[model samples]
Each structure stands twice: as C-alpha cells, then as structure tokens.
Target: MTIISLQHVTKDYGHGRGIFDVSFHVKKGTVYGFLGPNGAGKTTAIRHIMGFSKPQQGIVTVSGLNSWNNASTIQETLGYLPGEVALPEHLTGEQFIQMMMDLRKIKDDTHCKKLMDFFELDASGKVKRMSLGMKRKLAIVTAFMHDPDILVLDEPTSGLDPIMQQRFIDFIKDEKRRGKTILLSSHIFTEVDATCDEISIIKEGHIISSFNKQELLNMTEKVFHLTVENTKDYTQLIQMIESDITFQLISKNEQINELQISCYPSDLSKLIKRIADFPLLSFSEVPFSLEKHFMEFYDRRVGGELPWQ
Candidate 1:
C-alpha cells in the first residue's frame, strides 16, 4: 500500500526555484530515500507532504488524505523532523518534552523514556544551554515519542556525532523491521544507502533518477584500475583503448601510469586479453558504490558533465 505520495507536485518559486513535476510514493513498511543537496527543493517537496505548504500543481497525500486540506490531522499524527530545528530556548529540555506530550495528549511515557535513554539525551538542562547535538536528539525523541506509523525526517542526523549517527542508522533499521513507513530526505549518502529500500535523486527541483537500491548493486558494469610498468607500455595501452569501443576510460594518471576503465562484465575477457599485451605493474577491480553514483549526479548539477556523457 502507498502510505504517502506526491503526484506531479509543483511549487515553483520563480527564478527556476522550487520543485517541479515531482512524483514519488512511499509504500507501507518501506524506507524511501529522498536524496539531494541543500537548496535542491528537498525541503520544499517534504513540506508539501507534511501539509506545511500547498503545492501549485498536482497532489500530495498521506494515508489517502489530501495534505493541504487535512493539514492539522496529518501534522499532528505524522512523525517529522525538520531540516533545521528551532526549539523554544526559555524552557528546560524536560519541560519542552513534557509540553509536546501535553499537546499530543500522550499519557504513557514508556516510549518517550526509551527514546531519550537510547539517544542519551540529558533533558534536565535548559534548551538554550544544550549543544546542537543535544538539541537534535531532543527533536528526534519528540518526533518518535508518539509512536506514529509514518515518519518524515528531513536531514534528521545533521548535528549527530559519528557514534550517534551510527546509532540513529541502527535505530532506523529497527524501525523498518517493525514495519514502519519512513521518508528520509538527506544528502548523507551512507545513511540513505544503508537504510533505504528505494532511492530517488532530485536535482534543481527535478527528479533525475529513481531506482531500487538492489538493482544498482546488481548492475553488470564493472570498473577496473590498471597500472602499467612504464610510460612506454602506458602510452601503447592508451592508444589501444582509444581505438576500441569495448571500454570507456574513466580516469588516467600519467605519472603512475594508472588508468581506470569501465566496461560490462561480458567484456572482461576482452579487457584481460588486451591488458595481457601490455607490461603492467598491478591491476585491481574497484567495486561500484552509492557514493560514486551520487557524485555523478552532484558533479552534473555543479556544471560538470557526467562521466558517461
């Protein structure tokens, strides 16, 4: 079942800003990754789903209810962590948590205490004196305190330390096991790569690519790094590669006589035969990683052409 969805959603802010024709759905009990850098309309798209903003076109819905029309209901029930958290400074952390519980009319504190203890949050101090990491933990605790079925987290682990980040990642995995639907918007590749069932890369307010994480992992293309023994062999190999269409040169280092080439697995035999003709120092295959795919999109957005293009 589709728990949350945005269809042809557009919130154009002019000057080529805001999301355009964006569409994606988070299925029940699956974690969907919304990948993009800052100012890439990630927050804008998320805001539409949370009913914080109305879209100029298309529809945004949660549990079959229109987001804009059912703003109060959705906002009150959905677990949400904003990209930037702003807490009231005057209240103590304990008091703030209490205030949230009061608003939600939560009588039981079992889950709330578990979240605080798991995050190691010290809510005794005033909110103003708390560090950024502490504040982030507080926000996390509050978001999950009510045990909402659907979670929409925007850059949720921004201020967390490495240890805390890992804990949060683990916690997300646990939630997934418990059959919770989550929509995570983040540029942190590792977190998304580790937790998401499906991922969509958004750039300049457009959904550039969307695919199952497993499909990417099972791609047939393979990358190999070859290091020639000398400049003479390297020069000859470069010529051989340029004259053939079986492989694409990803990168080259003249000083080290190293070349990174990409080709299909079926062509590996041909590559080996061609490389055998050259005097090489070393050769190794580099595994494809999510970071590499993410960088491809990011590089293009920053005015650099894609490696394949």
Candidate 2:
C-alpha cells in the first residue's frame, strides 16, 4: 500500500525555483530516496510531503488524508528529521529530548535511552554549545525515539562524521527490517545506494528520473581503462574501434597511451580478443558508481522529460 503520495505537486516560487509537477509515491515498508544537488528543489518537494508547504497545484496525501489539511496529524505520527534543524538553545540536549517525548506523549524513556546509546550521543550539554554533529545526533534520537511507522528524513546525516554517518545508514537498514516506511532526501549517494529501495533524481525543480534501486545495482554496463604498450598500440586501437562498432570509446590520453571504453559483460570476450591483437600493457575494469549515474542528469535540460537510464 502507498503510505505517502504526491501527485502532480507544484509549488512555484518563481525565478526558476520550487518543485514542478513532482509526482511519486512511497509505499508501506519501503525506503524511497529523493536525490538532487543543492538548490534543486529536493527540500521543496519534501516540504510539500510533510505539509510544511502547501502546493499551489496538485495533491499531497499521507495515509489517505490530505497532507496540508491534516498536517498536525501527520507531523504527530511520522518521525521527521528536517534538513535544517531548529532546537531550543536554552535547553540542554537531555531537556530537548524530554520535551519532544512529552509532546509525543511518550510515557516510556527506554527507547529514547537506547537511541542515545546507539548514536553515541551525550545529551548533557546545552543545545547552543553542542557541536553540529552532536546536535544532529540529538535531533536523530528525538525524531526516531517514538519508532513511528512512517519516517521522513531530509539530509538526515548532514552534520555527522564518517563513523556516525555509517551508523545512521546501518540504523536505516534496521528500520527497514522492522517494516518502517521511509522517505529520505539526501545528496549522499552512499546512504541512498545502501538503503533506498526506490529512487528519484530531481533537478531544476523537476524530477528527471525515478527508478527501482535494482536497476542501478543490476546494471551490466561497465567502463574500462586500458593502457597500451606503446603509442603505436594506442593509435591502432582507436582505428580498430572506428572500424568496428562493438566497443565504445569514452576517452583517451595519448600522453600516457591510455584510453577508456565502455562495454557490457557480453562483449568482454570481443574486447579481450581485440586488445590481444595489439601490444597490450594493462587494463582494469572501472566499477560502476552511483555518482556517475546520478550526475548524468546534471547537464540535462529536459526537466521531467528524461527517462530513467
């Protein structure tokens, strides 16, 4: 079942800003990733989903209720960590957690205690004096302490250190195992790649691609960097590829007698045979990376028209 849905949601801020015709759904017990660079309307779209902003056009719903009209109910039930956190500076981290517990009517502090330990957070310091990373941990603890069925996290690991980031990623996997529905917006490809079941890439206020994570994980296409024995081999290789359309040349550097090519596993034998025909030096297959696939949409201008690759 769809736990969260945004249908043709448009919130035009003008001056070429805000989400346009953004449409996607987060199903129950699945982690959905919303990816984009800075100023790409990721936060804008998420705000609509959280009912923090009303869309000028289209519908935003959570659990069959209109998000804008039922904002309070959604906010109360969903565990949300905003991109930009706001905390009461006067309160210590401990006090802040207690305040959130009271607001959520959480009678037990056991889960909260576990969260603090799991994140390795010390809530004794005042919010104003805490380091950015500590504050982030505090936010994460409170946001998830309730263990809500649905979660909306925006740049959830922004201020965390590398170790803490990994911890958060691992926590997300645990949450998925527990059958929590998650909507995550982040620029960190690793987190999305590690945790998301579905993904959407938004750019220039439009969703350029939406796809299943398996599509990326299961991609058979690969890039290989080849170093030939001599200048003669490099020259001949380019001529060989030009004559045969089998191997695609991505780039080359005559200075180092090296070239890059793209091919699938099916063409591995053909590629090896062709390379063996020349004075070979060395070749290595470059592992496919999510950053490369994600950046392909950066230079694109078709808005929401581009299909997922």
Candidate 3:
C-alpha cells in the first residue's frame, strides 16, 4: 500500500527555486530514495511531504490523509531527521533526549538506550561541546527512539565520518528488514543504492528518473577499462565503437592509449571477440555503479537515451 503520495505537486518559488510538477509515491514497508545534490529541490519536496509547507498545485497525503490538513498528527507519528540538525546548545545530550521524551510523552527509555548504544553516543556531553558527527548521532538517536513505523531522513549522515556513515547505512538496512517505511533523501549514491527499494532522481526541481531496485539491477551494465599497446590499436578501437552499437565508449586517455567502454552482458562475448586480437597493455572490468547512471541523467539533454538504458 502507498503510505505517502504526492500527485502533480508544484511548489514554485519564483525564479525556478522550488519543486515543480513533482509526483511520486512511497509504499508501506519500503525505502524511497530522493537522490540529488544540494539545491536540487530535494529538501523542498521533503518539506511538502512532511506538511511543513503546503503545495500550491497538488495534494500531499500520508496514509490517505491530507498532509497539510493533518500536519500535526502526521509529523507527530513519523520519525523525521532533517539535513541540518539544530539542537539547544545549553542542554546536555541526555537532557535533550529527556526533553524530547517528555514532549512526546514517551514513557519507555529502553529503545532510546539501544539507539544511543548502537550509535555509540555519549549523551553526557553538552550539545555545545559536541563535534559535528556527535551531534549527527544525537539527532539520529532522537529521531528513532520512538521506533515509529515510518521515517523521513534527509541527508541523515551529513556530518558523519566514513565509519559512522557505514553505521547509518547498516542501520537503514536493519530498519528496512523490520518493515519500517522510510523516505531517505541523500546525494550520496552508495547509501541510496544500498538501502532504497525505490529511487527517484530529482534535479533542478523536477524528478527526472524513477525506478525500483530490481529494475535498476536488471539494467546494470558492465564497464571495461583497457589499455592498447599503441596509437594504432587505440584509433581502431575508437573507430570500431563509432561504427557499431555493441560497445559504448565511456572514457579515453590518449596519452596512455587507455580507454573505458561499457558492454551489456548480452554483448560481452561479442566485445571480447572483436578485440581479442588487439595488442593490449591491460584490461579489466569495473564494478557496476549507480553514480554512472545518475550522472548521465544529470548531464544528458532534454530527450536522450540514458547510457545504461
């Protein structure tokens, strides 16, 4: 079931500064990724879903209830972690957790303790003295303490180091397995790929692409990086790709006579045969990457087939 839906949502801030004609849905017990960079309207669309801002042209709903009209109830029940975490500097982390618990009327501290421990957060320190990563962990702990059925996390690991980022990624996976519905918005490609059941790439206030995890996997393309023995082979290789559609030129380094090409699994044998006789310095297949597909969408013109597609 769709737990959240936005139909033809348009929130135009003058000069193309807001989401426009945005529409997507998040099913129950799935992670939906809103992938984009800063100023890509990711935050804008998220704000609308959370009912923090009303859509001027469409409806935003959570569990079939109009988000704007039932804003309080929706926000109260959903665990939300904003991209920029703001906390009271005067309070210790423990004190802030207590305050949140009191405000939400949560009598159970058991879940909160587990979250703090899982994140290795030391809540005795004052917020003012906390490092950026520490502050981020504190925010994560509080957002998840209630163990809400649904969560909306925006750049949830913004200030975390690599270790903490991986921890957050693992945490997301654990939550997914528990059947929690999650909306994860982040520009980091790996986290989104690792956790999301569905992905929507939003760029310049518009959702340019959307696909499920299986679809993305089904469309995966293998990239091969190889260096030829000399310019003769390199020129011939480039010409070969230009003539046929089987091999796709991804990149080239003329000075070193090296180049990268993408080959669909169905055509890998054909590519190998076509270049088997060429004098080569080295050849290797690069692992599949979602970033490649994402950048193609970001850079391609208004109507062009995606490289992976």
C-alpha lDDT of residue 204 in model 1: 91
What is candidate 2's CA lDDT for residue 270?
89
The TM-scores of all predictions, comma-separated, are 0.83, 0.86, 0.84
- Best candidate (score: TM-score): 2
lDDT of each: 0.90, 0.88, 0.89
TM-score, structure 2 vs. true: 0.86
Runs of candidate 1 exceeding 4 Å displacement: 225-261, 265-284, 301-309
RMSD of each: 3.6, 2.9, 3.3
Better of 1 and 3 by lDDT: 1
The lDDT ranking, best first, is 1, 3, 2
Among the numbered candidates, top lDDT falls to 1
Tens digits of per-residue lDDT for model 1, 1-309: 999999999999999899999999999999999999888999999889988899999999999999999987986668999889799999999999999999888999999999999999999999999999999999999999999899999998899999999999999999999999999999999999889999999889998888788776655478899999999989889988888999898899998899998888778899999889888888899976798889878767533443443
For model 2, residues 44-157, the per-residue Cα lDDT tens digits are 987887888999999999998899999988877699898987889999998899899999999999988998999999999899999999989999999998988899999998
Could you give candidate 3's per-residue lDDT for residues 281-301 as a string of tens digits? 898988777887788888865
C-alpha-based local distance difference test score of model 3? 0.89
In model 3, how large is the Cα lDDT of residue 264? 71
